[model samples]
Target: MSILADVGAFALKLVLILALVGAIVTLVARGARSRGDDQPAPLEIRALHEQLRERAERIRLETASPAQRKALRKTLKRKRKDEDKAPGGQKERPRAFVLDFEGDLRASAVSALREEISALLLVAGSGDEIVLRLESPGGMVHGYGLAASQLARIGKRGIRLTVTVDKVAASGGYMMACVADRIVAAPFAVIGSIGVVMQMPNFHRLLKRKEIDFELLTAGEHKRTLTLFGENSDAARSKALEELEDTHTLFKDFIRDHRPQLDVDTVANGEHWFGTRAAELKLVDELMTSDDYLMQRMETHDLFGVRLRQPRPLMQRLAERVSMAVQRVREAALLRA
Candidate 1:
């Protein structure tokens, strides 16, 4: 064969070998990291599972008393030797439950937190502590009201709930944090925006200039609020103001009720405060990050992050797997190219 042909063949062989190796590595890596039918269970979950298994084994091995042991010995001769020993005789394991609030300070976060808190109650009894790692930028009125109530559940259950804010937990976010028995924030974390706001913009002048008019009809005197077009009546404006005031009052009451020490008038002016300043104003109890708390707690108890099992439909799981496979193929192609 010509030298050029030989070189071309060798190059092709080398490319093939490299491609195969790359594919194998990617496949193995993906397999290792693949989200199992049950969310790629975290280390904490696996630990919990192992602990439960050990506990069951121990219970099976443990005999109630000498009479129970003798009874078992008489009933089952082969089980005598094993009955005296405790199966997997490990020490009583420490238990810690996690309450994670991760996402926008909206209804989704609220719902998830609510479920998490409920689950915590299920696994945690009295004297157990909860570490709530909260990261939110605040959200709508009713949305955060529900979220705050979720945290309140922990308090109602007599669970010592500790909130850690590593990021901004302003407005509604702070509302949720305030319900905690103790609040912790990072030095630079934006902790509080203890107020409420209603935003409205009117385009009446623009519509009138364009020779457009909007006619809104309603039965109740103040049913329809100030609108975006066709001019707003003084009564409608008053109604809108009244609505804002009512919401603001509710917001203030929520804060006052949660943190009684907070001076409502000072913090209810629709202003935000940083971590250190907030601590002074009694918005947050102290400045501490989630990581620090986790590290400190790790020495005593295994930190288990508990989340509700989100049951995905079979079709959705299949679709996700197919999409992931396509992505892997695309990545492989890009690397080869």
Candidate 2:
């Protein structure tokens, strides 16, 4: 009888372990929403008006009476209403929505940007403007291509789209910037690189010396041009360059399609330029930092910031903690070395 009781206890423990694992799996699955699904991706939006109002209150406190401060708080609390009435009872100004994108080689921010675009499209009006604070050094062709397409959604909806680059927006990143109705960059910001580029290390000779073989097979023509392992031919190399040229042509055409005034031939040399040079090349429309643009806009327009992201699941959250731990270990090791 005691042995049977022990067996039942073990079974109960196993059931609880299984239930915990299932819960973690479900939570991760919830975050991976498909584009076709009717359910919107989990989004988080924040309005900067509260902070702005606090600043406004501080500015007025020196001369404002207790009654005036109370009235100011009341007026600021109705933040989302169309617009505040000025002295003559006329509307103050329109609204501006701001979003940020600091991209990686994979353009991973597109997932969050896509959801934000969807949310804004549902309510953005003609007078409303959307500003994207973009900073990227560029990356994979297809990855940034999709990111640019996501930005294009703003212009498609007839909402004014402004892209401000405080640092760099080169190569694949510039592909995205060109889609904006107006492009602004800081004085020293890096821009352009309107061409295609690819580089990879070849290990075929190293494998041959070690008496190892790397085999690759494909069923289509030009399927495996200029591979990392295997003897490459002149024909394969030529094909690769041809493909790059074709991609470059497509990149230039897209820029011209959007900004017809740009001299595509002069700038499509796979070169980068500073903000002032870029403006002269017509690669940018204005030279200004994102912070300055926001401050100037605040005079007549209400500023709001939006950010959307999936709530991290428990195990996923744990994985982040583990990653931080690993980074700390690596830093310690480096310090000792």
- What are the Cα lDDT values of the candidates? 0.73, 0.84
Would you give me the overall lDDT of model 1? 0.73
- Please give, for residues 276-337, the per-residue lDDT of candidate 1 as tens digits: 98889888887777877766766677667776555554446655655675566556555555
TM-score of decoy 1: 0.65
Clashing pairs in 1: 185-288
Any runs in candidate 2 off by more than 4 Å, and if so which? 1-41, 59-92, 312-337
Best by TM-score: 2
- Cα lDDT tens digits, model 2, 196-284, are 88898898899999999998899998888998898788999999999999998989998899889998989889899999999998999
Cα deviation at 187, candidate 2, in Å, is 1.0
Q: Which stretches of candidate 1 lie over 4 Å from their true place?
A: 1-94, 309-337
Clashing pairs in 2: none
Give each model a TM-score.
0.65, 0.76
